[model samples]
Target: MGCGACMTTPRKKGGERREEFIYHRMDPTDVHAVARKHARGHYCLCPIHGPDDDADLIRDTYKDLGYRLNHTEFFMIRSLSRIPRVVSPVTLKRVTTIKMAERLAKTAARRQILPEHVDAEDPPMRVYVALVKDDIVGWVNSVVADKATYCGGMYVQPECRRQGIARALLAKMLRDDRKGGARQASLLASHAGAKLYPVVGYSEVGTMMVLTPKKK
Candidate 1:
């Protein structure tokens, strides 16, 4: 498991150029060596609720990399019942169509989902697509273990952002989970997804920090 630690920012508030750090999770065993070859642009940091108070591991890991934890984010949990149904042109589809798979392949590089795995007759994971007037607009995937629904592969098209598609998909997700007899649902929310989850019944349950290379 990785942890967070931060360095001291310069006290000068005026005209001081602020440095930004992006977090990445990898084989933490050799971070200083591998990170240089495999870095990507940034995205939102997911919030965790209450984090472990022990800073020893986080402190020690970054100390070796010459970086420090800047801030800790809270991740959340919520009851499915807390999500209210939303009405929109977006209708949730249970299967991933050919276009859906291709669209995901082109834009979902960060998602790390295998193309073959997306359309198994009885996939080990459950997948759902969102449609806007017959065009695939978004999609999500989840797996149920220990009576909890762990979500992933949540994505919406760029052209369709801020139009309530993600929330509508989430609403369908929770609704279907309840019908499937699940008691609760959980997901690792990105900074972008955090805005939608809290509105449902999820609350901060833990914390995680991102690590990126320091500027040269």
Candidate 2:
């Protein structure tokens, strides 16, 4: 039996506040009951990841309940033993303060910085920022668990890309993870990221599908 998980976020739609339920790795048998219980008067999204046949069955089940494909991503992973030692032209700094996280959130247009961004708890999380002349231009973060690091929230300003900032940030994060005892890194790569991560040593392991209710 696959274990199901959900995350809820509040959003504003047409001047009205609503919630969105995002389900991850949910069991197929539990989908309808859970969706009915939590998705009333709200948006719901299910991101399925696994073997093709299993994912297809879950997708078909959602389709029968009026859901449609929202997007797809590649599930990529790489061993951390051989991260390239790319030198960043821009300065890189580890974010360890709420003040710094707030600045990153503002520059990245993120909703807000949470306590966990700087919390020193187990399953360690780390955020790194790229700076040019004291201004943040790119950032990336990772969370380590069970000897693997999951990387996400990677972004580089439009004007600052193609100059190796993204590569630098990734290299720095992966190297740090390796030093910290993580043996591998994983991420769900968007279309654009699918192109970039391969250059950094990640290999596609599977496809992930994001499904949402069809507009009526």
Candidate 3:
């Protein structure tokens, strides 16, 4: 917290005033503490109390967390994304209509969606799809929370398997989410997703499981 007193202020909907002091570019060299707070944790908007994308700030944040920023200004351990070739042109589209969800739901009801756990919905969720020549090749569902983004479902059509469509959809989804404002993205990687996340710049920081009771 050294450099100086920095505050983040965001205009309220009613044009009111609000302020917060989280972290700042000049905050001190012991950034590890700041990084620790953000380690496997929700990212706070820049601490300088303003809107800015500073490479120096990103570098310092990682440095504070004991993560080295390489010559390219990305985490030393992770590779900056290399845009993968699509192999074939597949249209990626956001499922703006509820119809798509309904479509997925119907497919789920028939157990066509790899995992049967995808059918239930509380308030329903947004869906994204990758289509080829009008055929549904892949789909993903996500819900956002204060701390993280939760991916509920990701399934590639059986016939489209092994064509790299799933990976393309995943990469597109993660990039879209990050662009939309996510400090970090996470998902309950299925058996297949566990293998894919790392390829797209996501590292395994934890594990997840489902608990259920058995009926005697």
User: What's the C-alpha lDDT at position 30 in model 3?
Assistant: 49
Residue pairs that clash (backbone atoms under 3 angstroms), model 3? 7-49, 8-49, 23-47, 31-64, 32-64, 32-65
What is the Cα-based lDDT of residue 19 in candidate 3? 30
List, residue by residue over 97-151, the lDDT tens digit for candidate 3.
Answer: 5456556556544222223223443223345778877667778765554434556
Work out how many backbone clashes candidate 2 has: 0
- Tens digits of lDDT, candidate 1, 1-216: 544322222324343423323233433445444433433332122112245544466556665765545555445666765568688557787655555666654555433344666677645466677777777678877666555676755788899978887777777777867666677887766676677778666776766664444456
Ranking by lDDT: 2, 1, 3
Task: Please name the candidate that would achieve the greatest lDDT relative to the true structure.
Answer: 2
State the displacement of the C-alpha of residue 18, model 3, in Å, after optimal TM-score superposition: 41
TM-score of each: 0.60, 0.82, 0.49
Cα lDDT tens digits for candidate 2, 96-162: 7888888987787663335675856553688899999999988998977879999867899999889
lDDT agreement with native, every candidate: 0.59, 0.77, 0.49
Estimate the TM-score for candidate 1.
0.60
Best by TM-score: 2
* Of candidates 3 and 1, the better by lDDT: 1
Q: What value of lDDT does candidate 3 attain over all alpha carbons?
A: 0.49
lDDT, model 3, position 14: 56
Weakest 10 consecutive residues, lDDT, candidate 3?
Answer: 70-79
